[model samples]
Target: MRCIIMSNELTKKAAEMLLNGATLLSEPCPYCKGVRVMKDGNALCVNCGKNLK
Candidate 1:
């Protein structure tokens, strides 16, 4: 077996979000179905206040 480590900030954050069962979406939030959604962080929504992290 082999292993690869993630060191980049974006990559690390993505991996963390994935492990936490959060979907990495660059589109609008499905909950509100609006375009006013803002990125709270690497894994959270500001509009609906959904913690993707």
Candidate 2:
């Protein structure tokens, strides 16, 4: 098996999305009030267990 490495630019973008809450678009989780939300189809919070949809 081979491993894939991410570039600095890509890593920065991902970090910005996860840290800056851009992916969540300023929407906080209702359950735990998490600021960051992953860009999944379900719009779930990463900090606590909550679904914002």
User: Top model by TM-score, which number?
Assistant: 2
Model 1 spans > 4 angstroms off: 1-7, 26-53
Computed on alpha carbons, the lDDT of every model, listed in order, comes to 0.45, 0.53
lDDT of 2 by residue, 1-53 (tens): 11123234344544666775546547776776755446555565555434556
Model 1 C-alpha lDDT versus the unseen true structure: 0.45
Q: In model 2, what is the error at residue 49, expressed in angstroms?
A: 3.2
Q: Give each model's clash number.
A: 0, 0
Model 2 clashing-pair count: 0
Off by over 4 Å in 2: 1-22, 38-41
